[model samples]
Target: MAKLISLFFGNAFILAYALDESTNQVEAINLKDISLPITLDSLQTKETIYPIPAMICFDDRIFYGQEVRTHKKFFSPHTFLYMKQYIAKNQHLPRIIGDQEISNFQAAEILMISIIHRIEEIYGAENISMYVFPVPPKGFEIFAQWIEKFCFRIGLVSFKIVDGGVCSLLAYGLGHELGTNFMYINFGPMCLDLYILKVEESSNEPRLRSVLLGGLNKNYGSIDIHKSLRDELIDYNITVRKAAEIVHHLINNQTFEEEINGQQLHFSRTQLHELLNRKGYGQELKNILADLIDLASGIGVTYESVQYVLCAGSSLQVPYYRNILKDFFGYKLLYNKAHNCPAARWSGIPSASGQWQYHQGQLRAPQPDSKGRRL
Candidate 1:
């Protein structure tokens, strides 16, 4: 069945989901279709409003869109939620790496509410029937009561909030036609979730059966690689930290050019593209690759059942990162596709990092977070 999928980002949330067969895919909906706006009282409401039609899918489980939009000014996308403590020290640099540590309760409730609101906006509340398949982080049971309370309030009285990685497996399973025996890895800013999914095709509709999922806390993300590259430059007194910061910002959007310190330093995306294409930075690129290899080795899945790798997020778009993985793992191993969104399309795939991601303690980062804080 065709469904209206909406992607939402704002506040501290990120959520996405597909509508079921019972729901109609409306290009437009009636104003009288919605219940009173969530924020407004029934007594104060005059009529209903319709929401937009958009497909929703998520890898990180936290709701994006409205929650992120509402809190955008304060939110830095690359930082890990659990590592907020490191934000203050690294805030000076254009790029800062930190893990976002949030209670599962907060993660689930806020995300559900945000998704419900976003769905209401697109299809109108009355017409929208959503099934939230939230990917639970490790130790999800701690948030059980919170999930129960959230379900009761959101009208998802009979919905499911499964593990985010498993949900991703479902999405990836459909996209890749993955059979019962493949594994799925979801690499995000805060953690990496790996799952061994067995699809039970015994029924007419394939179902995710007998899933083994786990979350790893090595926690090397896009910003960590950026910082590592910056440190490599600092060792030579090149001090391209500013440039590195701009590049990090550019990966997400092309607005960083306007924020350059001076016209001499004012580099556009085209110029940055050229910089990556130039021949002088081969060593720097190698250093970045070494870091990623180390990260994979530490994770113990470097040579595991990694048949197809999916790379996403702003980090993987960097030529420095892509070339290294391509050179070492071969062209097919790199998921840098021309037709893809470059960022979103590469989501959940493994790429490279610095010493922090390495296999052994011997290849540790030479210049640690000046403050010795590990990402």
Candidate 2:
């Protein structure tokens, strides 16, 4: 029998886990423990190399997540493929990486290949039975078909694409009994997604369905705040990492003081809040949440009707956003207390893990029918 693996393609990170049938343990693969950065002049480079690091090198040009602190040029650490504006669109816009003009499809394909190479190293190409991935509700079929084609090309035994919202609910259900209706908030660097989910029972098996979805506002996320802070402190030569640290501190209501190039820089919660307010971030968040609430109400899912509000993504850790959610949902908000569980941190993990459990007969959800309906 072959082993099962789950690969979660998150906005900021790519996480993978392997399931051991004998021990019934899910082992997480350290995605950061990737091999040296591969310098490829073209995306078509077919050398069977190890997984590339977070930083990719196009020809002689290199981008770094850690080096952003000292590097003069501002470089985004995230991949273009996961960006919200590109995820749902079929446009093949060209991005300038060094001197190379790489299309969106080429960059995404290269990234996908790197992810597959990493998985292949740990479990071996032939040892894997199936690979499961989860995609967002919007553009579900298109994204699922795109990922399925990639998996098929690798000659995997099988491949499955599950609904991202359902996966999140299942992951939460693994630790707690879920209510009949719940809301899932995925506030990440790329975008903020609000999902209203319903849990139904058929033939003693639980079936998960997305009742309604709203709030795919790409402009509103922690990344925007980070960029704002970086621009605000551009005169002081602040690095991206330092700006992010300051944002984290301010969000947690901690004062941050640092000296750079003989200049002292200080940031307070009040000051940061004022800055964000000036930039209309606070209002933008409120508007997005309000729109989502209105959309839910249209489908007859009122605030009081929601049983639980499950939160995911790193952006929700910010007090500004968390407070907004708390004020809106009150006591219905649920925070993942599994500090040690990777699923708690990444939005895609629970979905992938939930699918893994279903494959192992651990989760009691009925399989989807030909029309992708659970009956």
Candidate 3:
């Protein structure tokens, strides 16, 4: 039997998951480590090339993740291509890649094609029957259309685009429990999306109705937090790359003490918390939750009505955001112990729902409200 593949295109990473026939278990793959080569005639130079640590080369032209960061000449143009705002505003921007100037949309298309090809290589193309993409709630229609077009271009005939919030609920096996309201929050690297959904029995099958959908400002995300931290260290002549490392350490509750440009620097969890507060990261989350609560209240869904708050994405791993969520939801927040990274929990959706076969065609497209927000 052909397998079903589910993909979640995140701002900073692409996650692909499918059921393994041999083991009868779900396998999740992160596509970031896989690099596609850009063939260029200039790469065939006579100069001897030295191998860099943690670098993989293809056709002696393109390099892998770490190498691209190390080599100033090589660039990764599709770093945050999946970001909604980035795609909307800069889709036409030209990205120079090895003497080729590719538009942002073209780059995105190439990246998608590469992802599909990689998936096919892992699980033979002939053995995959369908592709399912779970899109964010706020811009579901636009994201669906864009992703559907790419699917068509890639010649995928059987595919589905479902609400990401609903998928998260199903991933947790909450789809069949009727009359319960669930809040799904995805704290991605680039942005945060929250959705309130009520499970109902529709014609003997579970149905998820959208109660409220909202997101933080597009500029509010873990990456933005990293940028803020980086800016704070700019006076010390800290490079962007080093700042990212420092931020990572701080987020993981590890103290970072280093000397840059002969100046000593130290970062601790307490310092990180203070920085987050000063930058209004916690306040922004609180404000968005308040707004979402107000909207949900208008629809008869109160804070007390929400049973479980399912949190996903790597950002939620950060203590600052996790603490904010804990303060807001308290005991209602749910975490997966089996999978430390909540975002990876999404990969289990396909396997959990048995490939979403029974629930096919039941998910309703979100309708826009007076302010054009999905409700």
User: Highest lDDT among the candidates is held by which one?
Assistant: 3
For model 3, how does the per-residue alpha-carbon lDDT over 1-375 read when each residue is reduced to its tens digit?
456676765533455777554454566665544444433234432221211211211111122222123322223333322122223443323434345443434556656677788888877888875577766665655666676666667666566666666666666767555577787777655555567776443332113434333333333566677667878777887666676677777765669898878888877878878987998888888988888788778777788877988887656667787788888889988755212322233323321122233222253343433444332
What candidate 3 gets wrong by more than 4 Å, as runs, is 1-6, 10-108, 118-132, 139-149, 157-160, 204-218, 258-265, 337-375
Is candidate 1 or 2 superior in TM-score? 2
Residue-pair clashes, model 3: 0
Q: Global lDDT for candidate 2? A: 0.55
Worst 10 residues of 1 by lDDT: 48-57
In model 1, the runs with Cα more than 4 Å from the true position are 1-115, 136-149, 157-183, 189-207, 213-215, 222-306, 310-375
Which digits, one per residue and each the tens of the lDDT, describe model 1 over residues 1-375?
Answer: 433332322113233434443542222122232211212124433222111111112233323232222222223332223123323343211221123222333334544465566666765655533333333334433333345455566545433333333334334333334443334333333233334333332221112222333232233334444444445344333334464566766665654534223333344555555454463444544554455446556555453444544443324555555555567655325343311222122122111131122211123332323333232
Each candidate's TM vs. the true structure?
0.42, 0.62, 0.62
Local error of candidate 1 at residue 15 (angstroms)? 4.7
Tens-digit lDDT string for candidate 2 (1-375): 355666655433455766654554566666553333334355644222222322221211113222112222122233332222322342334444445554534545666666677887777877765567756655555666566555546544255566665666656663234346677777655456677776443232224434334433343567678778888888898766777888877765678888887999877877777788899988888887788788888877787877777776666777777777778778888765311123322222222223333333233444565445443
Relative to the unseen true structure, what is the C-alpha lDDT of residue 295 in candidate 3, on a scale of 0 to 100? 74
Each prediction's number of clashing residue pairs:
54, 0, 0
